[model samples]
Target: MKVLVYWAAVVVALALVAAAGGGQVAMAAVRCSPAELSSCASAITTASPPSRLCCRKLREQKPCLCNYLKNPTLGKFVNTPNARKVAAACRTPFPKC
Candidate 1:
């Protein structure tokens, strides 16, 4: 009856929403690794403005910032004033972690 059809439509809509959400999650999967931040090292260490490539990499790697902060070796470099400046220029928010 009409109720059965309505329930089927609701299930289809829910499935579509779930599929779209899964695509977003997959897209957000860290495309850039922490090691790729090295492209910005000179700017980070010397207070120079970041290059276009550096900014692109920074944005791509934004999600990995917290992980970098947790790493002792990487944390020292990422937590520096120069690094913060570079990140700001790139419009990448420095994670609290």
Candidate 2:
């Protein structure tokens, strides 16, 4: 009986850990792929206001901004003044990383 109780407690603890970590996994599944921000390309390169679609994408991609900034190929584009403008226009807080 004691062994069974110990096993049950272990299982419950593992389940709790998995549940807590699942949210991070789900977040990680969505990447900061530059392709995802294609809608904002024009706004980023030009002085035109960002479109609704661009703002939506920017909001969705906010969590990945730091990762994008760290990427050599995407860093230049993501760290640009225009990109920052778009982020400001969209009301998405830019990641400092």
**Candidate 2 TM-score, C-alpha based:** 0.68
lDDT value for model 2: 0.68
Residues 17-61 of candidate 1 have per-residue lDDT tens digits of 334542122237764355456567667756779999999988887
Candidate 1 structure, TM-score to reference = 0.66
lDDT of 2 at 94: 81
Residue range 46-82, candidate 2, lDDT tens digits: 7579999999988877777776677564576689898
Colliding pairs, model 2: none
Using TM-score as the measure, which candidate wins? 2
Model 1 stretches with alpha carbons more than 4 Å out: 1-27
Q: What is the lDDT of residue 82 in candidate 1?
A: 87
Give one clash count per candidate, in the order shown. 0, 0
